[model samples]
Target chain A: MIGTLVQTPLYQWHVDHGARMVEFAGYSMPIVYTSIVAEHTATRTAATFFDISHMGRLRFDGPDAARFVDHLVTRRTADMPAGRVRYALVTNEEGGVLDDVLVYHLRDGAHASYRLLVVNASNHDKIARWVDVHRRRFDGQVEVSDLTNSWSMLAVQGPNAAELLASLVDCDLASLHYYTAAETRIAGKGGVISRTGYTGEDGFELIVGANAVVDVAKSLMEAGKNLGIVPAGLGCRDTLRLEAGMPLYGHELAEEINPLQAGLEFAVALDKPEFIGRDALVAASERTDVPVRVGVELSGRRIPREGAEVFLPAGASPIGGVTSGTFSPTLQRPIAMAYIDRSHAEVGTELTIDVRGRHEPASVVALPFYRRPSGRESTS
Target chain B: MKPEDLLYATTHEWVHVAADESGGKVATVGISAFAVESLTDLVFIELPEVGRQVKAGESFGEIESVKAVSDVYSPVDGEVIEVNEVLRDDLERLSQDPYEAGWVAKIRMSDEAALAELMDHTAYQKQCADEAH
Candidate 1:
């Protein structure tokens, strides 16, 4: 018999609200609250909350904390200012991505600076073990701890997210620039709020104590009930991220896929003097035959699902394969991301996706099939 | 509405037997409500042409949701006589009234004995409940 899946602090809330639960990353999570399209549109127009507690959170504390983090990730985190966050990838020595993570550089104490890392849930154990084995290369001053179980994470995202959250959070939301974090209290509970999101909207991610998160979520929902805030689920989360041109770990980044090929060159700082996967990424960057990820817009209504073969116009052989795809609720068309030969990764390149057995015509388009318009200035 | 007079397929399609203008029996086919609910957020569908022949247990059309795709199978061997082309654009009908207005196709039965393989309303309801667990 299979083992019981872990439940988030908001598990009962989701079920009470008529969410359809599914197993994801060893946890029972909500897949959809209502219709996927409805929830997706609500997030784009107003605000939506997602229970992201299943993601792993790690804390590093010590005199060499900054140095240890700089060695672990691909980005230059040692120089990152306090209260700032950067998206980075943890790669193996061979330049293959193990997981894409968000590194948060919080305030420094007298003896040590603190850094927090948020990683994918499915790779939580693997990443924890990877860090344990690699921290041996650093000085004994650094200490690493897994805080995944102690923290409950929730992301409130959309155009009206700031206004909705400002009513409940004690800190000033206006000063929190994009990709910045601050310690604050919400609904009388201590927490960390960051101006970051995956939905391509101006939003905030609130990390609170696992025991106190339910009250925070309830307060935010009550405050935003009139502002069209709805509780979103994993289904719309997948669609929203896809529309933003974000790459998921399992779908776009894998052990055999390097950062350059995944179009994540921005996250990799090759100028860093020393780091894991730097050499392999440098060599891979000079090579021209690597398959590059590109976005495709179908000429018809047929959705090109993951693992669908992409072929050249009138050609019988496969040229690439789709990584993630969905019927875009915002664009009202079928959009997908695929890894095709570098020669065929140009904008407007004509291609056909073998959706099941039928070949459907499509064209290479720019990444991010949709971008939300920036909202009004924060009300402080 | 659930139709007690219609025969149901194990694949969750309902069939209504009727007489054509020439007094020959024709089977009107549509997917059941359970099938529509399971395939949430219907996006697109491809139906068989009016003159195409279909065999029992063979796929005659396809439907897709945002995350999944499913085949609509024929319950009895016959030639397609008519199709509800309107469902191509208005997919909500599939879930709103799956038995009547959402009927996918009308086929002129080639073998009337094939209806013996289908289940009744009560039997199909029990099967759905059993599969739920």
Candidate 2:
């Protein structure tokens, strides 16, 4: 019998490369290699590669596919231009988050109408089953295939990421705007490259077919060696994203939280006719007492990790708990994201985070804590 | 690493025993270099307040790394006399020189007999080896 756990193609490579292994998202992923700070700095200054094959990828096709998926998601799939990508949260019927996914519309004059939905690895089977169960509701024309087992993914991130990738691929990387994606070849193998990332860095997420992923990743690593490209693990990935105030699944988004409360209001298309969670989200927006997702910078070096209590402004009782925290290399301090009372979510509001036992002071701050302007300006 | 003249704990704690100016036995305890290497990049430390009572084999405080949190157990039953407060800001001292600047706490042993129960240098090293395998 097969083990319940799965390892990516580069599992042995990670062990060989001195990765500190840990289980995350159901895969034995590298949480760190040597030091998280080193890998984080590499991504910000130059480039770093990641094994994100654990994340699930499913393909949808057929004539009425676009229209069918439009009903399935809050975003209007029919409106998505070919060779583009958009971030959307898949919600359950009760308005709870099913998963936050990036949809790739690959209708670049191809005869087939196909869209690739990339989802969190932990919720792969759950999302696949959910989509299958709801397939008939999508106007009975769209066919869904769980390509999760047949695909591997990599994300090369850094300010210099585009330069390295563009040098390797003949495609004009400068034309690609943030949130846009395209189907291209790397070393003569085809894959989808998207200009989106978990870390707030300029990067490309290359989705390779199962067979080609390993070779593509190896080539990218070799090509980026002089660029200080390190093989980053999930530990640095978490710290880097948290520094940029990105919400992680299960930490910031969960089955109990809707997009509105999680501060993902822009992703929810309220103007769209009807979708899952529309009614509940409408009612949810009316509630003034709903909690909000906010960022906090710890005063001291002591980091307030997940489950640590977050005391609100002054002597008031703790209104929330830390969802994720770490010593960010860029910010050079302990940064965290937590869900707290809307009253206490205002930027610059002082609070205390009880890190283990001591009350470490913190302050609420605006999100996307680090932003690097794209070399290519958005024409939109 | 700080060399504790007293017997050591198999959990990697070095205990130094000395007769106080009074008749009571005083034990200064801290983690060994091997333990510090096992836990890299210390982020924060929670040490027991001075004058707090602790039993032998009981946790006096904890040190947190990016990876895990490990409790520092008292080697002998006693009252906390002093704590390494300076190490709070500079936790690398534990990995740098666990024996001296990394001393976790000093305690006045309530029962001097507790020292007899701990392992000596050679035995503690063997225990550390056995546990790892």
Candidate 3:
């Protein structure tokens, strides 16, 4: 069974460093190197590196690149400058989210148009097929290719990410604004560096050739030894993103859950002339009876896991269910995101979570359970 | 108590049987050190209430970490007479002292035959090794 799972370029590095491997999205990825709590603390306080090569990388080029991208994503891409990155969603005809992706427009001087889209590893094959089927309209005017196999990606995140990664790459990372990327050289190899990360902390994600990613990662880890950079796994990645209140594809945004109901209206450009799901999303936005996503914090240490029903004290019927829940290492409490009735989604609204037949007292709170002191960006 | 002296169950619960003040058999139960390590970063543990009758191999309580929830099975057919209330808030005790201070429950045994089916220290160690591989 292990032979069937995909392995990243750093698979041997993770194994040699005592990582506990687990199957994730058909890949044998590191679930934890030591413990989830320790790695989560390191990412919040200092610096940490995560091997994210399993994420899909798709490239779009040719004359109709910008037009083709604007049609697929919900964000407007016509005015996106070179070295700019924007968060967008790809929705189906039913206005259900197909995937949430990062669109990068890094057109060099030589190329007239170039765009890259980073999609979730679990939805990689699905989105690729979706794009392939939709591109028949543009035929010879556009070219789409899968860069996931040829390129490896790594995320270096924390408060010290700018200073730590500066030693490995040949550019000043401090000047890189949030939600922007630049083409750079890492350890003499060409690559692209983006100032974006899933964690709430300040960080950068680098994409380089698959063959040289191992060397680049080793050099960065060696250089960051004094900075206390630890190799984090996907275990902490989920906790970190949950604490930041960012949505996971399967948990928060599913094929049946629309982006409007998930509180991602900022990523959707409804005014765009035409898109795959613009009409359905416009209708879904007017309906107020649909369940909306809200943050819930338990007064006790008991965690409200996925599918745990949410209810009021006077009612026996369930109002909603938890999408994602975890013990936040930063907040030191159990926090969860749930989709509840719009009437009860206000902050400070009292609710009870049925955690495995036990009623736990919880309250609606703000979106993010934890926020950094500074360097916060509102892109996502 | 040393691990070698305690009886083990395949579900990872450790049992120590002794005669109480009334000369009736009472079994002190807790999870093994291996079980505590496997359930890392324990956040919550639901302790079974006292005076509840439980069957052998039946789940009596639940233990949860950030990412997983596991049931703590009763290793013997008994009436639960006492429970560790401290473990409900202080989960670190389970990791620090899984055998002695981390004891989960105390049961008054109605069937002594269930004790004979449990494994000893050496056999339990072999079982853990086999499962690890």
lDDT of each: 0.90, 0.81, 0.90
User: Which runs in model 1 stand beyond 4 Å of their true positions?
Assistant: A1-3, A108-112, A375-380, B130-133
lDDT of 2 by residue, A243-338 (tens): 767788899999998889888887888788887777777778788797899988876777778898998647658888888877767877788899
Across A35-153, the per-residue lDDT of candidate 1 in tens digits comes to: 88888998888999999999999999888888988898999999988888999999989999999999998863342359999999999999999999989866667899998999899
All candidates in order of TM-score, best leading: 1, 3, 2
Residue A179 local lDDT, model 2: 84
List DockQ, one per candidate, in order.
Answer: 0.59, 0.31, 0.60
- Candidate with more favorable, higher lDDT: 1 or 3: 3
Q: How many residue pairs clash per model?
A: 0, 2, 0
Q: RMSDs, each prediction?
A: 2.3, 3.4, 2.0
Best by lDDT: 3
Tens-digit lDDT track of model 2 for B12-106: 78898888898788888888876887676677788899999999889888887765568888889889999999888888788888888888999
For residues B1-133, write the lDDT of model 1, one tens digit per residue. Answer: 4578889999998999989889998999999888898778899989999999999999999998887788999999999999999999898998899987898999999998779999999999999888654
Highest DockQ scorer: 3
